[model samples]
Each structure stands twice: as C-alpha cells, then as structure tokens.
Target chain A: MDDKIKMKVQELLQSGKIKGFLGLRERHGQVGPYLFTDGDDLEGLVVGDRFKPGDSRYPLNKQLMKITRGDPSGCYGVLVRGCDERGLKTLFGSGQIKSEQVVPVGIACPQDLADACECLKPYPDERVAGEAAEPRSFATVAKVEAMELDERFRLWLAEFSKCIKCYGCRNICPMCYCSECTLENKDFGDIGSLPAENPVFHLTRAIHMAGRCIDCGLCNEVCPADIPLRTLYKKIADIVEEEFHCRPGYGSPETPPGLNIRGEELKH
Target chain B: MEYRTVLTTCTYCGCGCGLYLEVMDGRLVGTIPCKTNPVNEGKLCVKGWNVHEFVQSPKRLTRPLLRKNRELTPVSWDEALDFTAARLREIKEAHGSDSIAFLASAKVTNEENYLIQKFARAAVGTNNVDHCARL
Candidate 1:
C-alpha cells in the first residue's frame, strides 16, 4: 500500500516510458497481479500488503516473463521486491530475459516480512519506497543443521512424504522457465501417481535449485502440503556459495550460474 | 495487452480447489492456486497446477471415435451412442449384465459419475460399477 509506487507507475505510463506497468492491484477486496496500461488506472495499486505487511505476495517477475514472452519487443515496468530483484537477476543470468527489457520499481520489504523470510538482503539495490531493514540470518537452515544426522533424515523424509505431487512450487517459480521440466518426465518421475518416491523427488528438485534458486520463499508459501522447500533450496544455494564463492541473483550475467562471482563477493 | 488471472475451480476432481487461471490476451496460459480459498488454502495437486494444459491440448478429443475394422474412426454422436447401446444390449442378452463393467473417472464431474452409476444399476441391470480413482 505505497503511494510512491503508484505515482511512479502513473508517471511512467503517462510519459510513454513503458507499454505497461506490472504490479499488484486491489480490486473488490482482493489483491492480485495486474497490468496497468493506462496511467489513470493507478487507484488500486499496492505492494502486496492487504492484511499483513507483504502477506499477499505473487510472483510478479514470473508474470513479467509471461507477458514478455507474449510480446517480446515491448519494454515494460515491473514491481520488484528484494526477492523479485534477485529473481530478475537470475533470469537475466540464465538468458531468459534482458535487464533492459524491464524497468524494476524496486521497494524494500518491511522488517517483519524480512524476518518472516529470514532474508539476508531485505532491500533491493535501488529502492523507490520503504527504508532499508536489518538483514536476517538464515536461521531456518541452521535450525535443520542443528539436528542430528538421523533426526534430519527422518525429518526431511517425513516432510517430503507430505508432497501431493503438486507442481505449485515450480509453476510459481520466477526462475523456472524450462520448456521441459525434469520433474514431469514420465520415465523416471512417474509423474502422475501419488505417494511420491519420497526423498528422490524433493532431493531432485533441490539439486536443480543449486546455482539457480534466489532463496525466494514462494515455494514454501504456495505448497499445499506445508513442505519447507525454501529451506531445501536455501541450503543448496548456501552450499554453492560456500564452494564457489558465487551466489545466484547477485552477479553479472556473463558466467555460468555456478561460476558467477559477484564483485563484492570477490572482495570477500 | 490484457493480462489477468481469472479465479476458477479446478475441474480435475471433486475437491473443487479454487485456482486462478492466467489469461493473457484471452488465452489460458497457466494456473495458480487461490491463496484465500478455504478449500485448498493455496495448495494445488499436480493436476490442479496443470488444469490449463487439458483445455488447449492438441490431443484432446473433440469428436467421438468408434472402432471400425479394428481402427478407431471418427463417428457422429448419435452413431456412437447407438453403437454402444446396441453392443451393450447384445452382450447383456448373450451373457449376464454383470459381465459389462462400468468404470467411472475422477476427471468427470460428480453428476456424471452419479448418472454413470445410475445407468449401470437401473438401465443396464448391473452392479459392477467402479471408479478409476479406486484403481
């Protein structure tokens, strides 16, 4: 519910700077992603805070990818929180999109929301609204690390068993743009049958998340079975960071995803 | 450049999980679970996530097909229904009604499943009714 973003979108659309501005719209007591083509239609613009701060979140960057694919030539503006900026960077690194194609209206997430995500960077590099919040530690991953080996195995297996074979995690992911997904392969995945081959399915997705996942928590939020997929992906990203000194969504788009070395990380 | 998500119930099963179908330029693109719906509570099964694919699948059956000379050929609705009814009658007269098993599917609506059971028991005089989900 930031008015500054609304004014910025309105200005950009009226000035013909963008063909359309992708952001959240509040309509009829509901909030969801909306494309504002006209500058006048900025009354219901929001930053995913309907009830609680940053509660009603959607993958705006995914929507951006969808619309961009539909009209490849048109430049557009998009709403980007810290996580979304990271996703956009990852997408750019993967050659799925160009940074020039999108003008991100960056907004820093509130402290409460950052804590909820246990985010290391709650603010985007460039913020149009909201002050910077204290970055949070990846306590969720550490909590798992604190567990005994056998206990961790049992915990993960139990969590993975709850999967209803819902691809909500992949479908909502901003970084997932592959034409063919390995998770849906009929040969090895057994795509349709339930009681998913426990740790294999989840672990396969985790392996795929390395060097790609931006540590966004949409996978956890959208999961119907309450699986901590974000934790799994975060762990994978952390491992990649430890080994290669590379982190996704924070580096130049020239190198391979695993070899991406951010300027600051190189300094470290 | 019209892009919006239309909130609709997943047609895959009887669970009636609410999901938003992403419609870009009047075409169905993807499915996202409705976060506020009490039924699903922002969780979708694999079928629910992929409900949009069936809508635009190239292999989807638009017309009925009938076996002719060991090949499935396109047939009109009346011909297909009549052919099926005649075969059912012939089997029932030759064998017992229980020999003709009727299997239902979760893909179809509950009303269709109800009618299928009714037809199996009342019209066909058989209690050999089953559901695909049961298998």
Candidate 2:
C-alpha cells in the first residue's frame, strides 16, 4: 500500500500535474478527507472503507472544481472508487464537470461493499490502491425480474411503503447533480405526502438514473426504510449497457446515446 | 439574499442524520450536510436537502398571536407568554394539572425542552409531557 501510494505521488508531483490531491487521511484515530498540497503532509494518506452517505468524495470533487474553476489552467487529483469514476464519467459527458482538471486516483471497493452497491465495475481504468475485482451480478435484480408483473408491483409497493421522503439517496449520489430536480415538482406528486403518489417519485428517479446512476449505493445506505434501491438502478444500468451499447461514464467524451440517436440507418 | 433550510434529521431514521439551515446569503440556496458533524459525515438525506423551505416560509409564524373573542390578533411576545401562562395556571387550578398537557417541539434545543418539562412537572405539576420525537 505504501509503495503504491508513493509511486502515484511521485508520478503526480514529477509530471507537474495536479495542484492537490483530495482524499481521506488518518487524523489521530479517525479518517477524514483531506486536501493535500505538494508541500503539505502525505504520511497519513490511506484508502479504506466504503461507508455510504458519510463518504463525501463526490461532493468534495465538486468543491474542488468549484474552487479551481477560476484557475482554468490548473488540475487536481481526486480519489475515485468505481462508483465515483462512473459518476465522473457521467458528469463529464453531461458537461457538469470538466475532465481535464481532474486526475482520478482510483480505488477498487471490497466485494461485500460491491455487492451492496451492485456495481458493474469495481475499479476505474487506473488503480492507485488495491487490486481490481471481477464485477459480480446481483441476485436481487434477478429476483425482481423473475417476479410476475403484478407480483413485482405488489413487492415494490410494499417496499416503497416505507419511504419517508428523506431524499438521502438523491442527495448522496454523485451523478444526481441537478440545479433543480424534477421529483420535487408539484405537478409530478404532492409535496411532503407519504408513499409519494404510488411509485411516481421512485419511478421518476429510476427513469432519471437510466443512463446516469453509477451504483454508488449511497442512496441505499441513507434510506431509512432499508429499501433495496440498488436493485432498481442496477437493473436499469444493466439495460442501458445492453440496449444503448454504453455504460454511463465509460465511453469517449461524446453525446449520450439517448440524445444523439441518428437516422433510421441506425434504427432497427 | 434570504433563504432557509429546515432543521431536521435524515428521514432515514435510526441514523439520526442531522442537517442544517442551508442558507445562502439570506435565502436557503442549497443543502450542505454539516461538515463538522460526527453523525452525518457531511451527508444529508433527500428530506434534509430541502429542510430550509419551512423556514423563511410565508407559512411560518412571523409574530406571536393570540385568539381573543374567536379572532386571532397579532400580539407581542410578552402578551403571548403572559396569556399562555395565565391560561395554563387557570386550567391546572380548575381541571387539575393532568388536564394541562405540555407537548414539546423537536425543533427546540435540549436545554429549552428540559426547562419546559421541568416547568411543567415541578411548577405545573403534570407529567403529561410528550414530544414529536419521544427522545
């Protein structure tokens, strides 16, 4: 771990790239994210844990961009787990954040956390810490898929019944950066009403996450109901990968397939 | 600029996720889970994100008021508190202390709430105290 971190640091500093690295550092006994400047400390840099909701990697990355936007010619290093990398890709594709200013320091998540996330990729194209793991399929999605239409609907209702409208899932997601969200629009559903208009809220969110969700599981972690939200987005992400021939944030810096569909030549 | 965020916990209870008044200038511009917080790790629930709305709200009480002769009249804080104390005392004296129940607000601080309960139990001599969150 020490060697891997040192090599990355050396390369980052030597290449004259990145004004700073934003990631967790061990402060006394607790670990918290830090902004490491070249002359500052690197002794406590470590990568571990996949604590959802508590993890501010996504928001910190946004803060870095916000802070460094005026310095157009500057760059910074960001720690990206699989979900964060995917989020960065989607954000770049959507023009929410710039790619040039970001240097992804990738970290692969553990299997238990990956399973909880139902992630398709456990690592980014680069690795600065830990070995990558083969992506695993989630049985929860399969189980939901296998259910008959009514049975699925019933199950979903039962699960969604517990929704307290905390909005934890959307707030914690890296890919869910919107100046204004449609879910809150009164036309879609009643404001502050429980069970949220029978799947309108969740389904709308699922549809929005169609080509956007990075399977971070932050939503699931923050959800008070312990709803298996991962299944919903994972299934949609899988469909996006299969049908669109693309995964969110993985392709070249091109328009999303949904918007750039061409003439009938490409249509079935 | 004026904005408000409602002070509330993550609705995904058990975690008791605390979030803030995401005030921008004076308006609640956006949600930022308190960074210095220990519980939330600077993360907010979806509900916590918009917590500021209920504050600075057109619906929120801007001034104390009292209903007199079946009509609400805007009143001073002194008048409101005096009226409330007199009413409670009358109720306790007439119908017994148990008849005058005290329901506390979750939005208030622990000290405020403790003082209220103490006043109710010792002064008013009623244990009919409950809270929005029974903590």
Off by over 4 Å in 1: A26-30, A39-41, A184-194, A251-268, B66-71, B78-135
Docking class of 2: incorrect
Model 2 chain A poorest 10 in a row by lDDT = A259-268
lDDT to native, each model:
0.83, 0.67
- Supply candidate 1's per-residue lDDT for B59: 96
| Candidate 2 per-residue lDDT over residues B71-127, each given as its tens digit | 989999999999998988898889998898888876676788899899989999989
Model 1 lDDT per residue over A98-163, tens place: 677789999999899999999988888987999889999889899999999999999999999988
For residues B1-135, could you state the per-residue lDDT of candidate 1 as single tens digits? 678777778887668888778999898998877665668767788778889988988999999999899999999999999999999999999998988999998778789999999999999999998887678
Clashes of each: 0, 19
TM-score of structure candidate 2 = 0.70
DockQ of every predicted complex? 0.50, 0.17
- Candidate 2 has a DockQ of 0.17
